[model samples]
Target: MTLEWFKSSYSTADEPACVEVSWRKSSYSTADGPECVEVAPTPSAVHVRDSKNPDGPQLTVAPTAWVGFIRGTTE
Candidate 1:
């Protein structure tokens, strides 16, 4: 199935800079702010784009790969 794109709730409309995340409700979303790097809602696969540049191309990747990337970057 094709996933629909969405913005991350964690993002603030106030901030000029926002990072779009592929959001999955409940699992990723919460009563609090949503996760970062919003992608199209779908299965394990995630499609990510920059909210700063809506017209920019997206990066598609598996959940594990995404996790590894974040882990690597933060480390």
Candidate 2:
């Protein structure tokens, strides 16, 4: 999958550094289906959003928390 970086628009003068995130579609996702999910992983956290609605609300979790979640699901 190609890496696509997006800059967060929530940056302000006080926090001039904008967050750049690279999102990737889940391997289980299909091109012609509705079960689309994407995840962006940074050093500190992981960001998740629905690929069907790119501009919709997103869910962010800490790196360790994300690991636990993945492990839980796989087992």
Candidate 3:
């Protein structure tokens, strides 16, 4: 399934410097913070980019790798 792009939860309304992600969440909620990595997930991989430069280069990794990263970070 193709997920829609959404602003990160760490982003605030006043700041144009935001990160957008394709997280499988129900609402288009933005977080309260500044620059962070943005993530967009696809069927095969997860796309990651620097929030400061949306038009810049992105890094793509397998979904499994992404999951492992998340797990590693949280634990």
Candidate 2 C-alpha lDDT tens digits along 1-75: 234566678777787768777788887888787677899887777889998888999999998998899899999
The best-first sequence of candidates by lDDT reads 2, 3, 1
Comparing 2 and 3 on lDDT, the stronger one: 2
| TM-score list, all predictions | 0.42, 0.69, 0.57
Q: How close is candidate 2 to the true structure, as a TM-score?
A: 0.69
By lDDT, the better pick of 1 and 2 is 2
Question: Tens-digit lDDT track for model 3 on 18-75?
Answer: 6655634223324654657767887778888766666799899999998899899899
Candidate that beats the other on TM-score, 1 or 3, i.e. the better one: 3
Which residue pairs overlap in candidate 3's backbone?
A: 9-30, 9-31, 10-31, 10-33
Comparing 1 and 2 by TM-score, which wins? 2
Using lDDT, give the best candidate's number: 2
User: Each prediction's Cα RMSD?
Assistant: 12.0, 4.7, 10.7
Best by TM-score: 2
Root mean square deviation (Cα) for candidate 2:
4.7
Off by over 4 Å in 3: 5-34
Off by over 4 Å in 1: 1-41
Task: For residues 1-75, write the lDDT of model 1, one tens digit per residue.
Answer: 245556666678787655554443334444455443445634666667654444578788997887787699899
